[model samples]
Each structure stands twice: as structure tokens, then as C-alpha cells.
Target: MLDNIEADFPEYAPRRPGAPKALDGIRVVDFSHFIAGPFATMILADMGAEVIKIEAPGPGDDLRRYPPVHPDLKHGAPFVWTNRNKRSVALDLKMPEGVAVARDLIATADVVVENFSTGVMERFGLDYEACRKIRPDIIYCSVSAYGREGAFADRLGFDPIAQVESGFVSMNGYADREGVRALSPVMDISTAMMACNAILGALVARERSGLGQAIEVSLFDSAVLMTGYATMQHLFSGANPQRHGNTSPDTCPSGVFRAQDCTFYINCGNDKIFQRLMAQVIDRADLAEAEIYATGPDRIRRRDELFAILGEAFARQPWSYWQARMRVAGVPCGQVRTVGEAIRSPEARERGIVTRIPHEKLGWIPNVTLPIRYSGTPIVDPVAAPAVGQHTESVLRELLGYDDSRLGRLASAGVFGADAARRPRQDAKV
Candidate 1:
């Protein structure tokens, strides 16, 4: 399925033969799964950190089984999107031998990230304190729903739950209907970005102080901040934000509108933009000069009347007609496009936002690159997400200097799970 899509789309391969990377010498031992944790580690990986992802022996990360699964890859699109530029090592953490190997790996890592429930890492003896014992200057990061400590530590939370609890869901959608949660996991994505930023900051601090610390990022806390300026507004006014749908409560002439052929949106942020919209785009100088439409507050007071006039005027022209004029007028406007349309739009193509990268089994698969640009240091080349335990043998051999004899012994002891124990010794080859 992915192969077909890549075949029709443009292929992208960044060319920078020997450029330095931002995080060239760093190594991260990633025990994170799902969106928040894995995504944070992926950002580090993109910046040239060697990220070693630890997963369970059989199923691996739960996100691997998410929808739109690839038959050959086994994992789904969500996992592929976040796990690039990383190696995967599957181990049975239930076994003492597996924990020993993890400790050995930790000793060689600069960063350790995990997002298991409050005490899961402590049970495996891989928590922040345990990791600090292995390597004193290790930067340990924990991503959780609430926090690793506190009364809500035991509570399980997801993106929708965080949105509802943090008032994010209360300030979206139309006022007439119940507020709706974002279809995208905004809370999870925002938390991941925050975790990445925190880790980067800790790395800088450690470079000067020669000390490591534990950092925590919570979904609820990030969601609350994701409410943007509304939180501050509520504090100042003591009034909660109301749902405004596509319209802006503070700005006049800022909402979805319909052109003759299709739907578009226009935002006249100030009086000048509104004047330009009237005199330049729609050619309504009478309305532009009228006292009722002179100021933002005045226009807002007669919003229904003004919008009705704009609506009738807009219905006379197609989206293309208004878009070109708006471009010249400097008015912020765009066609209300679907996900597919937006991805394939002319602007997206110009920005190279979506492209295809090579994959081992699939020949080539779709890849969405990070939106970062560096003059001296470039991000690492994209690599497809690894299959479960794909690098178990290689990681043990290279990082820990484990010999074939020791690997065989650990396998026999069920350190790599029963299925691995039953496989031929040569199958452990890197």
C-alpha cells in the first residue's frame, strides 16, 4: 500500500556528504513506546544521536499494531513515522539476564528515556536512580500522563482525556454544540516536543556542570499550555473561553467563507486589512468608508451585517479569483482543503514537505522530514523503522562486546524470549 503511494510521489534524498550533525557524539537508550516517548527520542535521533530502542520480544511496542498496518513490515504507519533513524533491540525484561544486558547498555549511553507507568521502570530496576548508578552523568527523562510522583501517578491517561481535563476541549468547535476533541493527538505531540526540548536543555546544562538530572514531562501539563493564550486571558478576565469554531472572538472578518466555486477562509486582523479587503479584493469602497465598518470594535458590533455583505460579494467569484487578489492585497487567506489536498498542494510541493525515502523490504516508502534547517550541521539521513529485535545481536556485539558464546547462553536462559531461544545459533548473526 505504501509502495504504491511512493511510486506516484516525488522522491527526496538530502545531499550533504560529510556535514557535521548537532548531536553527533550522543547515544540514547530509548525504552519509550507510543507517541510521546518514541517521538521525543526520534527528534534526538534525527539530530545524529544513536538511539537504541528497547522493546518486548514478541509484539514490541503497542503502537506497532496500530491501524493501517503493512503486511511485510508488521508495524503500522504511526510507528514508521516516529521510529526512523533508530535501532531496535528486543529483550524479555522479565528475565534477570535481560536486565543485566540493559544495565550494560545503559553504562555506555549518555541519555535514557522511558514512559512506562509510574513504577514499571522501578520494578525492572531501570528507573532514573538505577540508571544513575550505572552511569552517574546520564540524563534520565520520564514522560507520563500526570507525573511519576504525586496522587495522580497511578492514574492512566490518553490524549483525549488530557484535552478534556486541561480545558483544551472546552474552547474549540462551535458554541452551539458540545466541544469536540482534536482528531490529531495534539496533547501527545505537544508533550513529545516539550520532552525533546527539556532533554536538549539538560544536555546543555550537563556539558557545563558535569552532572545529570531526572526530567519529567506530563501530558496534562503540556495540554494546559497548549490552550495557548486562553489560560492567561482567563486569569486576567476570570472568564472562560467560549467555543468560536472557525471564527476569531477578538478579530473581525476572521472566519470560514464560501467563494462561488468552493470554500475559503479570510482573516482581516486589523482595520487596514479590512479596508484592503473591501476596497482592493471585493471593491466595496462604500462599506469600507461607512462609519459602522470603520473600526474593529464597530465592525464586530455589526458582525452579522458585515459578514452577510461579504458573503454575498464572495459568492460572485471563485476561490482562485479571490486568492490571487488577496495575495496582492496582503490579506491572510487560504482554501479550506482536506488532508490529502493540503499534502498535495502546490505550496507543500514547493516546501518539499512530503517525499519518499528508500526502505529495505518495500523498495521505497513515504517519509515526512522534520521541519529543521541548519547551515553547518545537517540532520542524519532517513532510515526506515527497524523490525522488532532487528538489531539485538548487533547492539549486544558492538556496544557491550558480547561474544557469540555469551549471546547463546543468554538466549538459552530466555533473555530474548522463548521464540529466540528455540532459533538456531546462527540466526543471532548481525
Candidate 2:
């Protein structure tokens, strides 16, 4: 059945034709461990950057042990999602030799990204200053929970914590209920996007000035920035926005409404769209003409009644019916898809958003393709995330030109371990 389509449809044939890609030859030395920093580097990697991920010797990144580990995978899904399309090298940066090797890698890299807590890199003597000394044209990006010199610099933070501290949590969920914190890693991913933007901007600047600069992005700052429009409303208009539960505070009919079997979101932001939606999609011309529902503010003032009317109308039909009607009416609407549904959706599959790459241990794993699509250059298939110390010997010998004796000495001293495959074949080489 599948062969029939490939044989008949030339456009949809399984021909390995090369297409246009964007990014070509950039190199990134990723020193980041967790989601935010690594995510940024992953985007760059997808844009065709040669991203080398440097991890510590022991246990590797903590994310490797995170939950939802596929039965055949050593690391969890989150780790795989954040760390595809990169090379891994384990180093004991606390040692002088290890730090030296890292410095050499930086010397050959175009960008350096790290999200360590404030002063960790400085303590290790691998901060921006040190890297810049080796490569004056390096784009150094420091991502943290807070800025390095800020009052909250030393305090640890994650996505939810930043959401609370940055006022995002206060504006979410129900009006009558307490503010509900988002379980999604919005702050982490948003901060990653911001960091990526800064790094790309710095790269552009470096092209002009023939020099590099250090850039900083923090989750706290990004979370606050995401709340800009809402914050300004509070400041300029003296309106304390309350949790309205799935609805936009400034726009009416901009929230989830239920149907017979599913829920969908409809965003009627402008009066014209609202009128069109009412007349075409709902066939409610009288409701559109009512003075209480005519203007934007009037709709907000009578939001409860409007919601009741809309909700009842929507409840009368199945979600698919409303979706088709709304599509024809040019109203912005979408069904709320679960993670599995969205990933396996026809549109997602057609766009190649979900791709399969083979792993040594796991036969094939699904990796979400990077969203950026280029016309001239595209991301190549990346090496799977390494097992602990997977390339220890190869990295040391190739990067530093270490001999067998030097590599043996390092293994004996516990500075670095040999490859996993060689461990059972021989004792410590040193």
C-alpha cells in the first residue's frame, strides 16, 4: 500500500533529492549542561553549526537520569530531545590538563555557550575572559537563572520558580482561584530562544567589527520580558490583571471552548473578525448586532454572557464541524491536541517536524527536527548523545595529540577514563 504512492506520485516519491539549506559552516563549543543552554546550542546545531558538547567525567549531565527513559535508552527523552546533533567529550575540567584541552577547543570554535551558576566558570578559570584570550573573535554566551551581578545571582532557579518570581504565575489560571504555575518549561525554552537570538546577533556584529563580544541572558529577565504587554497595562492604566483561566485579558472569545467530543480555541481579537465569526461561523447576526456585544470593550464588559452564548453554541456541534466552519470563515482556531496527537499529526508529518535517527543502543529514536529551515544549508544527521566517556580516548588523543603513554597516565590518575568498549579489555592503561 505504501509502495503504491511512492511509485505513482512523482512529487511524493522517495527520491533523495537535495534541497536548499541555510547555515553551512559555523562551529559552537557548548559547555552548557541543562535545558536552557543546551537548547540554544541545539538550535545552532540544527542551523548547521558543528556543536561540540563538553561534559564532566562523572555521571555526565544530570538530565541523563531524568524520568521517562525509553526502555532501550540510557538517558531520558528530555536529554535526547535537547541534545541531538552534537558531539560529546567528557573532561574533568577541575584538572589543569582538562581545562587546557577545553581551552584548545575554544580556540577553534566560533561560539561558546554556558549556563553554569554565577562564578562557576570563573572558579574553573574558563570564563569569557579566558576564552576570549584564546580566540578574540569568539561569541561567548552566559545563560543563568539571574544575571551574574544581580541580587539573586547565587540563588538557584528553574522554569516554575522564574515564573513565580517574575509575575507570570500571578496572571495565569482562574479569576476566582489562586494563580496556577505552568508545569511546562516555558521560561527555560523562552530563555533559550533569547540566548540563541543574542548569539546570532553577536555573530553578525563580529562580521562587521572583526571582534567578538560576550552576551548574557537570564531566565528571570526573559520571564519578565514575556510579561511586557501585561505589565505595561498594569503600570500605565493601573489595572491589576487577574487570572481569567484560558482567556486573554484584553480580548474576548479568545479562550478554549468545548464541543461535543473535544475542546478548541477561538481568538476573535478584532470587531471585524468577531462580526464575521458570529455571522458566518455561528450564524448569529442578531448577537453581532446587539449593542452589548458590538464593540471590543462592550464584549469585555459582558464577557460572561458572551462566553455563555458562545459556549452553548459551540457545545451544540462536534469539534470537527466547528473547526471546518471556522476555517472557512477565516477565524483563528485550532483543536487542543495532546502531545502525542500533535507529534503524530498529518501536518507535522508532512512538514518533517518529527524525524527518525538511529541510535547505537536504541534502534531508532524520534527527534523533533529543528524548526528553522534554510534554503542553502541544512543540518546534517547528528551523532547520538554519547554514553558516559564514550569518546574519552579519541578526544584526548585527537584534540591534544596525546600519546599512548600520556593517555595511560591520565587514566591511571583518574583524570580521564578510557572508552567504554576498552574498559573490560584492559586495566587502566597508565
Residues 318-403, candidate 1, lDDT per residue (tens digit)? 89999999999999999999988888899988877788887767889887788887788978888888888888888998899999
TM-score result, candidate 1? 0.97
| Model 2 stretches with alpha carbons more than 4 Å out | 1-23, 397-400, 418-430
Model 2 C-alpha lDDT per residue in residues 1-430, reported as the tens digit of each score = 1223222222212212474333456788888987999899988876767777888776788888887865565678789889876777777888887787788788888899998889999988889998889998989999998888857889788899899999998998898878888787899999999999999899899889989999999999999987768888889989777888888778887888999999889899899889888899999998877778878888888888888989999999998899889889889998899986886677787887766555565555566776765545655555556655556666556656878877666666555533432452122121
Q: Which stretches of candidate 1 lie over 4 Å from their true place?
A: 425-430
TM-score, one value per model: 0.97, 0.89
TM-score of 2: 0.89
lDDT of 2: 0.78
| Candidate 1, poorest ten consecutive residues by summed lDDT | 421-430
Candidate 2, pairs of clashing residues: 20-375, 21-375, 21-376, 21-377, 22-377, 408-430
Error of 1 at 32 (Å): 0.7
Q: How many steric overlaps are in each model, in order? A: 0, 6
Query: lDDT of model 2 at residue 412?
Result: 62
